[model samples]
Target: ILAALSFFATGSTQTNLGDNFVLGLSQAMTSRSIKEVTDSMTEHLASRHIRFPNTANEINRIKEGFFLKHRIRGVVGCIDCTHVPILAPAEADEDHPPIVYYNRKGYYSLNVQLVNLLVNMKILAANSQSPSSVHDSAIWAASIIRTNVERTFRKGNNIWLMGALLHICRNAQPGTPEARYTLRHSQTRNVIEKCNGLLKMRFRCLSKQLLYHPIRVGKIIYAAVVLHNLAIDFNLNDLNDEEPLIIDNDENVPNIHNNHDVLNEGSRVRANFIRRYF
Candidate 1:
């Protein structure tokens, strides 16, 4: 069942899975059954695996590793948001309009965020079900992982999470401290970008609009992340033989809300990091 779930979650089509089913047990699995098993496996793997470093010592190790490998100081993790295309709800009411799923890219999707503490590009934590229309920063503000990040900092830990330029910077002039910081930040943070790219590449299902309901679609996305982590842990690096399929629309630009502190904190952190390191 785990093998079958992996096969399907790793971008195999239902028809192919059914055709290649392994005899007796294979006879029992319909498209629906495949989804159920995959979702269950996702729940199991996510609960059992996907560990994020919690202690200050653990976080400090990650920070030191980033500084040593990438010369980016104070960064313990790289964070980024990706969109998972999904079909609009079949039945929409005033409370659940189709527009709820229509993102700025003019397509329906779920704005999923992932954080990577490991350099192998495995996700340590994810927020996978945010509405596509919501800004990336807004999703971060509401996420449990963000709460952890804040707590880690408030403890005088001084750990930072590296994010893309747009999310962290606004309009600093060229040669400015903010500009220099953004350059180094984006370079080190490319791990999340590659992680997201390879995720969509390995699970081609993410490169297209899923036919399932949004809720089930989110489950499938989570399953893919879990499987990706397992592949890394088990040393299955051969999965990237083919070139990754590029999703046409990139991540949404943050629609800055009235939450002024989010932006302020981003600027403050970048400035401090630059003055201290760069």
Candidate 2:
């Protein structure tokens, strides 16, 4: 609702919808929890004769998924780092120091690099909390994709390269056993990148310093994502195609029983969101 209002309320570029929405949302939050505030805002927008998505669930799916085509399952949105300045941390703790960051924080202002994935553009898998120094490859390596699989297998601590099916396959030579296996496993993961681009374009607040507290900055991000859903739900834009790059079939990928039915704790697969997350 804030996004919708911001875009329509002003003709001037001084107040970006992404930034203003966050400001308004943070103010609204002064009287309510995030969820409560959002519910109230939905009602308020309706009363003001402006329409917004009726629910957060709908907002996440229809608005962001269809409108923006942010196709990472359980991801709400994706964003890479844009630079920032920050006051240095007051401690010598190595974990908190600015190593890879630019010398602005004396220390450094860390940008949270993430792709907020959505499963069927509904359920949000929160962004991974990692340091700014972490690159995309590193982030993907540390992702729940690997961790969850390891946990399921009751594996140990080391990151096994052979287990990185996608990477191993991409590096393999043609017609060889392991090469054939690696080539088969490699997946084209680009939809999420496109989502990142759209997000930066739509939410300018994320591209620059918010000049607000870190908490407020976070609100700014959330508000933009919420508003993104609103625009998509309203048909301001259309969904993009999200298909993984499929190399030659290796026949080594996990095979599960087709005879039995499985669900995500919900008792259904396709019904989980009615759309496949690429």
Task: Pick the TM-score winner.
Answer: 1
Tell me the lDDT of candidate 2: 0.37
List runs of model 2 lying over 4 Å from the truth: 1-109, 113-123, 128-170, 175-187, 238-278
Q: How does each model score on lDDT?
A: 0.72, 0.37
Report clashes for each candidate as comma-separated counts. 0, 17
Candidate 1 similarity to native, TM-score = 0.84
Q: RMSD in angstroms, all models? A: 3.2, 13.5
lDDT of 2 by residue, 1-278 (tens): 44433432222133343245555544334323433444554435323322223344544454345335422233223323332333344356465553654333343444444333322221122232333454444555556644543453354321111111223323445666544333322321343334444554555445444343334344445444555555655656433447332221112122222323321322242223222322
TM-score of each: 0.84, 0.39
Off by over 4 Å in 1: 2-13, 19-28, 93-96, 165-179, 240-249, 257-265
Candidate 1: residue pairs that collide: none
Clashes of 1: 0
How does candidate 2 fare on TM-score? Answer: 0.39
User: Tens digit of lDDT per residue, candidate 1, span 112-160?
Assistant: 8888864677788877777788787778878887788788888887877
